[model samples]
Target: METVLIEHFKKARRLFRILLVLALLCTVCIGIAYISIFLYAKIAGPPTLTVPQTAIFYSSNGKVLDELHNGQKRYWVPLESVSDNIKEATLAVEDKRFYDHNGFDIKRIGGAIVADIKAMSKVQGASTITQQYARNLFLEHDKTWTRKFQEALYTIRLEFNYDKDKIFEGYLNTIYYGHGAYGVEAASKTYFNKKAKDLTLSEASMLAGIPKGPTYYSPLLHEENAKERQRIILNLLVDQGKISQKEADKAFVTPLFYAKKAQDEANAKKQDASYFMSAALSQLTNELGITEAMIHSNGLRIYTTLDIDVQKKAEEAMNTVMNKDSDIQTAFVAMDPKTGAVKALIGGRDYKKSPFNRATQAVRQPGSTMKPFLYYAALADGFTESTAMQSEETTFTLDDGVSTYKPSNYNSYYANNPITLAQAIALSDNIYAVKTHLFIGEHRLVETAKSLGVSTPLKQVPSLALGTSPVRVIDMVNAYGIFANGGKEISPTFIKRIETAGGDMVYEAPQEKKQIVDKRLAFLTTHLMTGMFQKELNGYTTVTGKPILKYLSRDYAGKSGTTPTDSWMIGYTPQLVSGVWVGYDQGKQIERVEEKAYAKKMWALFMEDALEGKKKQAFKAPKGLVSVNINPETGDIATKSCSKKYKAYYLTGTQPTTYCRDKGVSEEKNQAPQKQKEQDGFFHRLRDWF
Candidate 1:
């Protein structure tokens, strides 16, 4: 028995020796592994921490107009800027031992391993904050053993390189929050409609709860789930001794003011000056030679000429008047004629629905709005405002194709005889415009449009006189502004300056001006344009017969345009030039008969609001424009004895030399018998040649 006991003791001793050897080897292996990770991290250096900063847009009023973020909507804030409540809540919920652990928690990892083993899938995560930061910053989201091994390796590296504060800041700034928002600042703005620094204890706890499962705990979506998660966080805070049970209960019953998800989403979508910022950024992108990613991430400050009041008014005008569900889109652009500073731009009914800036980007037929360009071309040629053209429809064979084009009046009612050229413009007479366009040489008209800043293509077809050529609203506004400015053309400009976050001025838009036309001719054209809204052009009923002037008492020149699908009302005061376009995005013709009145009324309301405080402005008549009395029927100089007479404006040499025949009251009496019938306002049922 003693011999057997001694042998057993020797066997046990030998087995204990073998087990000691294995334990030492495992300890040595772990030490070497840790040392290797540390050395590798030291050699690899800190991970690239290029967190994107928010880009701010300032309005002319010095108020923050908007902010632009990266694709993830991330805007990094330093650790010091974070709310203490948020930090404690996040620590209590995400990683209580974040400062204690080197990179990971072994007990949590063991539990996760057991859980994953039973579930046969990654149903739980054991990553500490540092480990999560490691996976998010440098590693992938794969759940395989290899990815886990790599994640562990990176976690060790991060712990070796960065402090706890840095790791925490990066994690808080990069973690995904619900509603497509990333980072605490963005999340706070998105979910609470406030800055992250302003987050209350309850709000911070709620936000801190979102990072674990953003979609599942979104306060905007899963309110009950979010409350439950928040409760869990507050309880964890209490258990972690960061707060007492009394404080936790106080936070638990706190009335939370969560951001109205739908309204918040709508506001975010309709962010202030979205279209303006987009257009301004496009201009900057070309000049700076950078992509939009750089624009959003490079921490640039854009100072723009957007007027918040005007912009809001522009939006209000369209929103108050137009049908929301009809899918009809509208555009409003207002610019100072003197400086060409674009004050307001509403690109579409909703910037979220479409970012296509119709104000400056879309090309549509200007309809009768292009007539001023034609008339300006005529004045530059030999024709005066008093020059007469036959108002009846005339057919012209196309030189380019086997087709004949016949242009008719929009109202389909003409004077049946020759009317003065000024009358043609006031009436928007298509036949008279076509005749004058052909007479003035279509090429000359194109040159005139180009000189005035209509940069789109204008095919020299016979229908060009009736605005068949597509042009932008900006182009039309700029062109009309030429007359408003007494022939000096100012380029439409939006951005005033751009600076870097470091206060380096990158871009500053200079005032672009060019003398594009004769001052007298531009003045005469302005005079001719005002006739569209006058009760009569020198005692004869005009085609428009005061359609717009009846709505507003301002002494301004303006015109209305319509295709089957598009409706336009553009006008200018001496102080500002404004244009509004109403149409469908898909080019669907307006369905309502009240469409024109709605469009015009919107224009009038906006103009009234815009010109409210300022004294009414008047266009200056440049030198060398002649005012003369003429025989209404003869289109010639009127003798004092001629009873029927009309006032006309003309260039110095373009005034008529002829006089009324029979030279007396006998002939004037017969011509003056009928008071010109008050012409009905033009409905603009255009002759759709397409």
Candidate 2:
């Protein structure tokens, strides 16, 4: 029996030895697998971090107009650069052993495991700063055993390959902050309009506390929660010997620095000269293969066409008037007539209230402001400025057969007498303009408007003579610039140049001018129209019963127009052409004032400020155009007995050769009867006597 037991014991020992050997082999194999993964992670590059191009717009003077982002993601930033207090506080609250540990904290991991097991929840995370960065850069945020294993391996690799400072920098730069902010640098600028290097302790601590879960503790959002988190971080910093208890106590008492609302920030950014230029930049970025990220990071020096002083004045004027009434929205566009460079543009009272820019986006009827184009076209079609047309109140039946269209002057007074072309334009008589349009045919008028950069489609109807076509304010302004520019149409351009992020010029806008109309005709039209600003009846009165013509103190010309709702005043000097449109977004009619209040007020404000110190340069007349003293009504050369000897100007082709026989008087009885008889000649005398 003893012998049998010994043999059985020996067999049991042999079985135990075999099982131990197999277990050891399995352990060795698992260790080898982990080591391989760790090595691979150390040598392999991280997955590519893709950044979507941010949309940035600038004003003409290099001010930011808008910044649009499609994605809500951003990178992390270093804690020290983020904010000193924030860094210490965050280190205190999260990963207290961050600086001391290699890659893992066994004590924290053990404690987390115990707590997690007790709560039956995955509430505790045992990730160190290095491990967290490793997971963020290479792995997904999943709480699985396999992911954790991969994270540990990568963390070890990161620790070996990167220095402590680099690892911290990467960790901070890779984590997401709330509010679409990625790194501390971006967050600092976004929240405080400052850089990370300028952050205070409290600011830094607040930023540092955000990454634990940005949404739950965003300073812009839940300030109370953010404050609480900040306090916790401060305490942690105190406990870690990074700061004093008294310092932490003082920090706790400090109020949280709340950031401005997004809308407010957007407004602040736009109140600079570069706002529109930034907008142009954004457009060009897409067209020129440059990205917004490159622009932000590359620190580009963009030279634009904006005059800073003019832009400031425009913004100030708009703000002053915009504050007066809430219902009215005003738009102003100014351009260099010579170069077509947009100098100043105010889209609306506040871009936040309505981002729909009336200057560039809203298409409204230009009202009678379109008369200049028709008049210019008439001159080009061999219609002399002195040529007479019947300006009596007239009515016409349209093919539509809806109603009889009776066009009258703005004052509803038209003499049933012959009026010259210059009189028709100066009086802005709708009937005369419509009759002229009919005489020339609608097709020719449409073609003329198109030739002058009127891209809006016009209907072949008589009503078009009254400027009923839908057009953008910018387009209308450019069209008027053609007359100012001696018949050459230069398309408006906002961007001066676009360069790559690396300082290589990628796109430079070409200044191309096309002659769309005869220089002689343009000059003639401009010469005759300049009369509108000379007289009080030409619509240059002030609100206080004063004449604003003297304030202009220069040779300028413009027209006032109003439809049912919109009021427009477009004018030009030798150097600048500007247009102002005043109306409501909802399209409501405005009461007309003799002073032309709304549009005239805006126009005068823009021009008086825009041309403050400029020379009073006269519009250059094309060669062969001449000015002559004539009777205002007859458009004939004025005699000594003429009642009103206005200096009537006309192109040589359109000037009247005959002098007024009765001088300035329209009726023979107003002048000497014998002189009038002599003016009528012997043939008329024979008929009269018979």
Per-model CA lDDT versus the true structure: 0.78, 0.70
Best by TM-score, which number?
1
Q: Cα deviation of 527 in candidate 1 (Å)?
A: 2.7
Candidate 2 lDDT over 1-690, as tens digits, reads 999999999999999999999999999999998787666866674433333323344445566544545444232344455555545555676677887888889999999999999999988988788888888778888789999888887787787767777877776666677777766666776676677778777777788888888889887878789888888887777777898889878866877555556647766754553335444554557565556666554434344566666777777766655546457787788889877888887777766566667887788988888878888777766666656666677788766777677766766767567666666676777777898787667887788888888788899888899988889898888888888888887876776775532357656767777787888777777766666665522321111212346456667777778887888888888799988888888887765453246676667677888888888887766677777777766767777765555676555534455677673344323444554454445324323422
Candidate 1 matches the true fold with a TM-score of: 0.74
Candidate of highest lDDT:
1
Candidate 1 wrongly placed segments (more than 4 Å): 1-39, 51-72, 92-126, 156-163, 215-249, 261-332, 336-364, 382-420, 429-432, 486-510, 518-520, 536-540, 543-545, 562-567, 580-602, 622-690
**Per-residue lDDT value at 481 in model 2:** 85
**Per-prediction backbone clash count:** 0, 28
RMSD of each: 8.4, 7.7
